[model samples]
Each structure stands twice: as structure tokens, then as C-alpha cells.
Target: MSNHQNPTHSIELTREATNRYVARNAAGVEVTFGRGEDLMSPVELLLAAIAGCSSIDVDTVTSRSSEPTEFKVEASGNKIAEENGGSHLEDLNLSFNLSFPDDEGGRKAAGLVDRLVKLSHDKYCTVSRTVEHGTPVAFETEISVGREEDGNKDTE
Candidate 1:
């Protein structure tokens, strides 16, 4: 059997306060976070990571597929405290709406979405797997076609 492994990656953070901190990567992307008076405390950054990962994955996969496509992704989650003390997200959802030409191509697009999500979550997206161990993740996709001039898509 061929042995393959995903590269291990890490993020470093510096604590700022009881509920605030800053995170950055070697490439210099920085993110500042705080509790913001919410029940979830501070792991919202992880949710954003999952969302961003899936979004990029979907867009890339669709664009490289049999048809030209454009899309957007939105991800959200509910956080609940675990019995042991730490909080965990309860329900995480990701929604993808894509636009492409032709109904036949759209159908193929749907199948491609399944493969994309699996590849992202299972093989590539560390954020998704990490969150999944703590909570349930769900995803949905909608396919459409054509673009309009007003900075918005006109779906049929």
C-alpha cells in the first residue's frame, strides 16, 4: 500500500486577556478575537475556519469541473457547554449555492459537491475534523445558472 500523510500544521496564539487573544500564521495573516458577551465564549474563529475551508474547497472543485460555476458558502453553529466543563458546538451547518450553465451540468455539479465536501472535511480541512469530533456537522448545496449586472446573480 502507498503511504500518504497530510502535513501537520500549527497555529500560535498570544493571550491578551480573560476573553481576548490574537492568532497569526507564519505568512502574516492575523486575527483578533474576543468573547463579545456571547454564551459561546471564544471558539468562533474555529467556525470561521471551517466555513472558509469548505467555501474555498467548493469553489475550487466546481470551477475545475466539467462546467463553469460560481458560488458562495455560509457556515453557522450552535455552542453548548459539555458536562466536563469546556464548551462544544452542537450543530454546525454549511450551505453552498452555486450557479452554472445547463441542467445536466448542474446535476453533475451536485455530485461533485459531495466529493468536494468529503475531500475537504476528511482529507484536507483540519478545522472541520476537529470540530466534528466535538459536534455534528451538516452541509447543503443549491445549483443555479447565469450572472447579472447588478453585483447579484439572476437564478432561473
Candidate 2:
């Protein structure tokens, strides 16, 4: 695949506390996250991303037939911390539940969701594809240290 074909998403974070951060996405949407009980953990966000990506695919196809009366997705996963550092999700599970009107159009939409979900898991959803393929992540870090008298100094 061409690198140019890939979509890039960015997140900016502001430190609110030692374990708290306000994360903002490329679209200026902000999400507060931390180690606190009330905040969404990083692992939860990962599962959410996976489920959301697939749900959007199914929703698009289902909506083409008829509007869904209700839609919901529940995602869960087991996180195993590595001996060195970081962690990975295992046994990922996603349950998709949706409702539609009790009519022919609704029945067609309902069936469409199932087909679209299979398509998403097989090819359409980027998040699912990345997870299934073990896509390599290249990391680059740049540090800027500025002083009152001196301008910004960059170090990598």
C-alpha cells in the first residue's frame, strides 16, 4: 500500500496532573483521560476505537436501507503487560446490537448490518485491519527546550 493513501490522525495532550491529561484530536474534539476512576483509560479507548470503526461501517450500509431505531456496541479486551514495558490487548470481543422498525425495510436494514460488519472485519475497517495485521508503528520524537534569554533549542 502507498504511504500517501494512509490517513493520519493526531492528538495533542495537556498535562493536568501527574496522571491526568486533556487529549485533543485533529478535529478539535477533546477527551479527558487519566488514571482516575472517572476517566477513560487508554486501553478502553483502544477497544472503543476498534468497535467504533466497525460500527460506522455497518451503520453506513444499514442507513442506506433504513434508519436504525437503536444502535449500540459493547467492546472488551484483556490487557497483558509485557515484561519489558507497555501492554497489548488479547481476546478482544465486540458485540453489536441494533434495532429497527418492524417492517420490510427494517428487516432489510437489519440483514445489511450483519453483512457490513463482516465486510468491516474482513477489509473495510482500518483499526481492525491494523490490529489483525500487526502493523509496524514508527516512532519519532523531538524535544524542544526554551530559555528566557535563548530561543527554542531542538533535540532529538
Candidate 3:
């Protein structure tokens, strides 16, 4: 077998109520999401992950020269449903608007913006690359039935 190794990234979600959940990462940081009210939906989280991955790529490269005065990235897509009951996002897009101060370091950083953004989307961003390459996702079921007492926690 080859000696190549890949790091694993994972998050676990626990349901709070009927439609609400809390997602926790390995570091224990948590984010609450759900279906009711103004909470972000799963689709929104996917969009954010794409934009966030690209943002990290661009910032890592650009900040080597100078810090950005402003950095904003927006991910957008049309959620569409097929006749077969499957739904997916269409026309997905990520837009970046970054600015640097008016000076040499800033100019140098600004000069790298376009290339950095392109490189991020085409190469560096794991999230976007995984989507663009159509990576296969395998699903397995490991459900445990809780009995007797206070609705024993599930969702993980």
C-alpha cells in the first residue's frame, strides 16, 4: 500500500428539538441551525462552506504581502427540484470583493487578488474541488434504538 495519508475533518450534529440542531466540530465549537425561523438551512451551510474554503485560500496567499482592508465573499445558487424528487443547487457561484490599503504592500497584495481567487477555485479549495470533481459520497446506517427513559439522545 502507498504511504500517502489524508487528514479527516468531521462534524457531529445533535438535534435540539423537532427541526433544530447544533453542529459541533472536533474543537467543540458549535453552530445552531434549523428549518424554522431565520436559522440557516443546510443548503446555506453548503454555500458558506464553499465560500469559506475559498476565502481561506485567498487570504492565506494574499496576507503574505499585506492584510486586506475589506474581504467579503458571497456564494449563491438556485435550489432546484427534479421530477424524481431529488433537489440540487444550480448555477452556483462565488463572488469575492477584497480591498487593500493604498500603499506598496497593499498594491502588491491587490495585484495578486485575481490570480489568487482563480487558483483557489481551481486548485486550493477542498470544498469547491470536491463539488466540481463530483466526489462520491457513501452513506451507511448505524442506528441504535434507545429505550426506557427520557427520550435518550440520538442525532449524532
Residue range with the least summed lDDT across 10 consecutive positions in model 2: 147-156
Q: Per-residue lDDT for 1-156 in model 1, tens only?
A: 885767756566777787777777878786778786643335566676888888777766676645645666677788788899997566788786666777776677667887788788787776687666664546666555675557576665
Angstrom error of the Cα, residue 144, model 3: value is 3.5
lDDT by residue (40-149, candidate 3, tens digit) is 99889999999999999889988998999999999999989999999999899998999999999899999998998899888789898999888899998766666435
TM-score rank, highest first? 3, 2, 1
Q: How close is candidate 1 to the true structure, as a TM-score?
A: 0.59
**CA lDDT for candidate 2:** 0.86
Judging by lDDT, tell me the better candidate of 1 and 3. Answer: 3
Candidate 3 lDDT for residue 1: 65
Q: Give the TM-score (vs. native) of candidate 2.
A: 0.83
Residue 99 of candidate 2: its Cα lDDT?
Answer: 98
Order the candidate numbers by lDDT, best to worst. 3, 2, 1
What are the C-alpha RMSDs, in order, of all predicted structures?
17.7, 3.0, 3.6
Q: Which residue pairs come into collision in candidate 3? A: none
Tell me each candidate's TM-score: 0.59, 0.83, 0.87
Off by over 4 Å in 3: 1-3, 148-156
lDDT of 2 by residue, 1-156 (tens): 755565767899888998888989888999888788889887787888999999999988888888889999999988899998987889988899899998888999987877788899998898888888998989888656653446656555
- Give candidate 1's whole-model lDDT: 0.71
